[model samples]
Target: MLGKTASDNRVFVYEVAGVRQNTDNDKNSYPFRSSSSVFIKVPYQRMNDEMRRITRMGGTILSIKPWTSNNGSGEQSNDGD
Candidate 1:
């Protein structure tokens, strides 16, 4: 969970789209299809950095919200864009 601190207890989820594998990605030892959307668990403190990184990677940020369960059935608060 991101953004879990002594004072702040909120965790965030980042919904990213159009992330393609590049040379920077070491996981791509072989060819594979890129998923259109990716769900990233980001902490509040690192949100800005993560957003910047995502942008540099040519990914679009669809939405950002508070962390919920794996199924995303928990409460959702759109605190980040």
Candidate 2:
């Protein structure tokens, strides 16, 4: 993990809905199909590939957004003014 900074890691959150379970995806065992939308975390490198895969499995992406799970204990702190 040398020379790796926090900014170097790229991740995205995909809010997808209407995922259809079919033969091709059945083999892959995608068990996130439901009536509601699901959150899928995709790396930057596999963004396009994952999108294609989802589409192939009959999924509609509701939205795509850059995500980072640094909500607490990151670099920000509240100093009493």
Put down candidate 2 lDDT per residue, 1-81, tens digits, no spaces.
578765457767777887777876677533545566767777676778878877987889898877766622222111111
- Give per-residue lDDT, candidate 1, residue 27: 50
Please give, for residues 4-79, the per-residue lDDT of candidate 1 as tens digits.
4652655777888887666544454444336778777776767788888778778899998767566464332334
- Residue 78 in model 2: shift from native, Å? 34
lDDT of model number 1: 0.66
Q: Once superposed on the true structure, which residue ranges of model 2 sit more than 4 Å away at CA? A: 1-8, 29-32, 70-81
Tell me the deviation in Å of residue 47 in model 2: 0.5
Model 2 vs. true fold: TM: 0.67
Error of 1 at 2 (Å): 18
